[model samples]
Target: MTTTTDSPRWFKSSYSNNGGNCIEVAANIPGAVPVRDSKNPHGPALVFPADEWSSFVSAVRAGEFGNL
Candidate 1:
């Protein structure tokens, strides 16, 4: 696991309407993207490689998941 001394700057999409099933992502971290539940800010975060995260976001934006 990658560890960093810097704190994560969490961000949630504006499209989220306070829905209970929303996730917050921290893009400020270098080389990694940390994601956690918006409802549970104190909970554990799942970190992914920055490149992988970018690809996943691109796929979502391109509707690869279909009606997600």
Candidate 2:
């Protein structure tokens, strides 16, 4: 089995232009979602399971987290 590292290629969300404090995520990793701070590329990344990450996104889009 081979392990893939997602330390590179962090893509910012298209809706992050106005919010300078937003974070970015590098999607479609081998088995996890790689997320990192947009202002700090050299910083550490937080990896999340695909299912959990998707649920979080869905909640955010559906206003489950309240006002954006």
Candidate 3:
């Protein structure tokens, strides 16, 4: 079996405007989620375990971060 590492397909939320502080996330990668600054596509990306990323997203959706 041949395994290939695909490139990250980063995207920010539709609600995001031209704000330079935005972050982009790539959910396409299996087992991992890559996050990076939307303003710097070519910059380094931080990879997080899929489960952890999922939990973080869920918390955000549930407003656990409190108006972030």
lDDT of each: 0.89, 0.79, 0.84
Each candidate: RMSD to true structure? 3.4, 2.3, 2.2
Off by over 4 Å in 1: 1-6
- Preferred candidate (lDDT higher): 1 or 3: 1
Winner by TM-score: 1
Q: What are the runs in model 2 whose C-alpha is more than 4 Å off?
A: 1-3
Please write out the lDDT profile of model 1 over residues 1-68, one tens digit for every residue.
Answer: 55472578898998998868999999888899999999999989999999999999999999999999
Ranking by lDDT: 1, 3, 2
User: Model 3 over residues 8-54: C-alpha lDDT tens digits?
Assistant: 67789887887788999987888888889888888888899999999
Better lDDT candidate (2, 3): 3
Task: Give the TM-score of each candidate.
Answer: 0.88, 0.82, 0.84
Better of 2 and 3 by TM-score: 3
Shift of residue 64 alpha carbon in model 3, Å: 0.9
**For model 2, how does the per-residue alpha-carbon lDDT over 1-68 read when each residue is reduced to its tens digit?**
44477344568888777566878787757758888887787788898998899999999999998997
